[model samples]
Target: MVRHWWLILIACWSFSLSADEVTDLYESRIEVATQSRDDRQDALREAFSSVLIKVSGQRDVLERPEVSRQLSQATNYLVQYSYVTERQQLYLRAQFDEQRIEELLRRANASYWSARRPNIIFWIAQETQRGARLIGRDADSEIVPAMRRQAHQRGLPISFPLLDLTDLSNLSASDVWGRFERPVQEASRRYPSDGLVMVRVQEGDNGQGYLAQWTLIVGNTRRSGQVDTEDLNGIGMAVVDSVTDRVAAEYAVSYSETEASEFTIRIINLQDLESVLLVESLLRRLASVEQATLARYHQGTAEFRLQLIGDMRRALQALELDNRMQRVEDPWSVTASPVLEYRWLR
Candidate 1:
């Protein structure tokens, strides 16, 4: 099983995977024991559940009454599926209908996380019988493959450091083992990522199991978790799940509105036509927004009026998740004004 994941990781690296911009959010692959009709049906249901969890960024989404009813008929939501073989293991790769999935989330009043997700860079140090070593992009270790498998399962984008001469010169195994946020964040600047994760794993008491300590840093907010399991794969899965919960809570949009509301925002620091187009595209692509139109452009600043599915607050929260813009606290604007202010970052 671990070897299968290692091969997948190598293939992903060859494609120069970027975690920030995620595609195929509505697809999932589940390992099946056999290719029989009964097994195929069961795998399809599990794959549908995985898609729901991945799309909503919530592992417990299947527990909702509406979602559970839909899951009972998971085949209705599946767009296509085919059997795939890897490492002599049979699997089902399934694609679900995106629009239907979004409607199901709205019916359940659950949060929908768009494909635009944060890219988290990880620095991991481990202690084993041999000694301490850091896992890097080029590491041929079991831990890296396990972590990558978990990240893909959760629909989270994660990157490991190159650990080349430059990285080693700036960071050490002890620095990550200590969970130092400053040095880790400083060294991670070379990689364009939205979050920083530092982890340390070692043998548990009496060498009976594995224990992992992880810290997640996104901007000013920070979170940490500890996991202990009898095997390395369990530790990796738990650590990734813990971080995904935090990130999803911060970014996912909870659907509660029956109709769209009009909202306006002003974005400054636009450099050219390309910047303006990118800003409009981002606004229109937000899960909370129904439509976006440029209302005004003056003095290199642009104002967009958006038809949002949620309230202004929720829309603003969604905007904060994208790194292309930064909220600006304009002192001249009235406190009760409905229009928000931001500065384009690119």
Candidate 2:
């Protein structure tokens, strides 16, 4: 089993948050709705495709030669599944073997994307029968739910602006539609995302398909792409998938980084046993952290020596969840030794 499986079990059993509740997409599982088991094989392929897209951050991963071959034998990789009926519809929750899939990806020479993805602040412009409008956080509009569903499916952490007076004072739909990142990012200060995706959607030249233009902005950088879809439901998903492929290309690491390395990190301001246990569990449960041992605890601090696998970026990304550990930013007061800045959020 991959180390992520163990982390999933521990998060489910010990943490207050469920595995699904975490923004980090750790589980290699996906649920598909079907009318009957007759669609099981197709569902198997779709589920595998979905999880693969989420893990590899490649929208075209299914088209890879080896991946395409495996899709024909998708059922062979299924670890287990359960059937549930909801609202007169049957849903299959399937779990695939992550280790096997990682091996397959390795054989294909594809790197594995870390779960610590950047939050994307989506600025979407929609042209409706009435007029064009921006999709805000609380617009009570039709497109918001559709786009959100797509975000959930792709396992992309996406958010929309509140479009309040503060935002209105700075930007308009025209700014978003124009693909202007300077003024847009200036307005997006409160949203604190690693990047921004600006989408402009209108009727196509044929007046049937959706004509869309998009750009992704990250730290003075921009990547642009377009998608023409007959349906509105998949438009946002298509844009997100394209930009994420680029982001993954930049950040993904090798899956073979499972060799354990000894590492020691210090935690400051731990007040009690609960804090110590919580701190240790946070590190030990990370997929990148093979195991963690408390070497000693003294003077409101704890020192842990850990056996680590996976990339350092991944370990840092796991620590970002729930503000468990934060990097020391101040240059002067920081210790010469590596210290993880943490505080109980009570």
Candidate 3:
């Protein structure tokens, strides 16, 4: 009887010790999970803090303390946690950063004036013939008008008036100097111009439908040496297209570098909120975003009043809902009420 009693007591003690060991193991797991969650949260907070500083500098307008605080909190939450899948994570991050994205868009408008204004000018061509009744009637006649129209469309300022063929016929050699040269010289004198375009129609074939050969002169220099055309209209269109392309090329090359910088900065700020939110959602239940009111006080601390979508219990439950058994941890907490005493360290 004494041996049996002693055996029963030993069995009871062994069972109790085993139970205690199991309990300790469970507690240890919970503690480890809790500490892991805390560590993740800290890492997320630090990343968000760094990004927020970059955003602040990029923003053209100063952000209100409350707004900055809310953004930081949301970003921190997004960084710390993630959903079960990459797709779900993406969705949540988008939802979280929607407001900040809007703010960045507003800031991007500040770069509108950074684009260089184009310098445009109008160009006119003058042609003179010794025996022709009209001043502009040579084979090059059709081309001059086409070039003028092209310049106008390209936003170039043009001042060439269409010369009446009769005016050319009426002018003698002496009047030629007075009529074309004096007017052009006066124009150059009064207005600043890049150059003048002049064309001389040396010959024409009426049977070939105004077929002509001509020399193109730009400011006192000859450009085509000589060009022959079966149709004056075709020549005019080609010249206009060529000139416009040349001008546009010059402007584009000169401004490309400056424009690229301005465009990059503008696009980044405009998209910052969306980008951050996307990154957050990709990270998911490990992190959750809440909309919150934020304000900065005189002391430099940022106060936040967060509003979560679900109740506290629901949010807390999310932290433990993963089925993968990957990691069990309570990653985050939100105050159920609108108490504003908690402040974020910048």
Candidate 4:
């Protein structure tokens, strides 16, 4: 049974990778009341505002004068648009030109979080008059939809525990509600993800609202916070927003109005031509890297020189967001020869 569940998760992860690779970063959707001309115009403006927040990873990006100035002309950047209905609600799906939006951000000197984002696994425990219960992928709870909605709005990739027999045997709702990192992490080992998040939801002190306390663990950083709201959806959305802000702060690169600089990186354990192509593609996809070229190649080792729009430190930081590249620490490492070193994980 555990093996079956693991296979399903692996399949899902594979499908999501294909989706993420082709996903448009500048596309957004906004709910609208009718198909009137005024409503379409208003929806496009609001949709662009959402895109700015998602792409820049800055909640206040629309508040920037340069960015706000372009909001009135949001339709000028739209490459395509369509109307879609979901759950009987109409939405305007707008696909804006990615280059134009990035250029606007560059002019605004805003932060840019690339489409290559961290996939976080969530473990949520909700307490009520009945008792405590865990929310899984198939859980019939309002928090699930609320969390998914918020994560999608912010362009975050999030997943929930399978809560199969194997999961139930390893973890309990009490364990998550108590914020026990050890057990939560132990249970999370089966899922392939970049980060882990645990949330505990209960009635607020005022007895009329919900309180969600969450802990996020990504790399060596740990962030914890609490959100109080009048309903479950608010608590879920607020928690996701808080988590996105923290993750984006670490991964997003600030656009600088400066000339591009060169940086060299060494990656070992590249055993095939496909790995080499993938490495170069990943480097080239980063917003910080203007261009990436293979400098040299040896037996199972390759060095790539990158023309970066940002500093070397920030470029390396952005590359670290992808889990396939594992940083290799060398005691004798020097900046003059190789600025960064990593091992390509299969």
lDDT of every model, 2 decimals: 0.83, 0.69, 0.32, 0.85
Output the better candidate (1/3) by TM-score. Answer: 1
The residue ranges of model 1 lying beyond 4 angstroms of the native Cα positions read 1-19, 129-131, 256-263, 269-275, 307-339, 343-346
Supply the global lDDT for candidate 2. Answer: 0.69
lDDT of 4 at 156: 86
User: How many clashes would you count in candidate 3?
Assistant: 24
Candidate 4 residue lDDT tens string, 206-276: 68899999999987779999989999889889999999999888777788547668978999999986677
Q: Each candidate's TM vs. the true structure?
A: 0.84, 0.70, 0.26, 0.87
Task: Identify the candidate with maximal lDDT.
Answer: 4
Taking the tens digit of each residue's C-alpha lDDT, what string does model 2 give over 1-346?
A: 4346534644555545423232534333334556365577777777778777777767777787887788878777778776777776667667778778777776665556545556778888888787667889887754567777666666667788988889888988788878787778898888856678888889888688787788887644578889887867666556766767766655455554555567677777788766776777777756566678777778878787877665465566556654445555667864565654555442
lDDT of 3 at 173: 30
Tens digit per residue, CA lDDT, model 3, 216-243: 2223333332345566666655454444
Better of 2 and 4 by lDDT: 4
lDDT of 2 at 222: 74
Displacement of residue 278 (Cα, Å) in model 3 is 41
Better of 3 and 4 by TM-score: 4
> Which is superior by TM-score, 1 or 2?
1
Residues 1-346 of candidate 1: C-alpha lDDT, one tens digit per residue: 6436533543343222234766878888989999898998888898899889998999989999999988868889989999899999888999999999999999999989888788889899999667778988878777788888888888889989999988989988989999988788889999978889999999999989899999999756689989999988788788888889888877778775566689789999997766776777677777778878778887889998998776666667667767667988867756666678899986
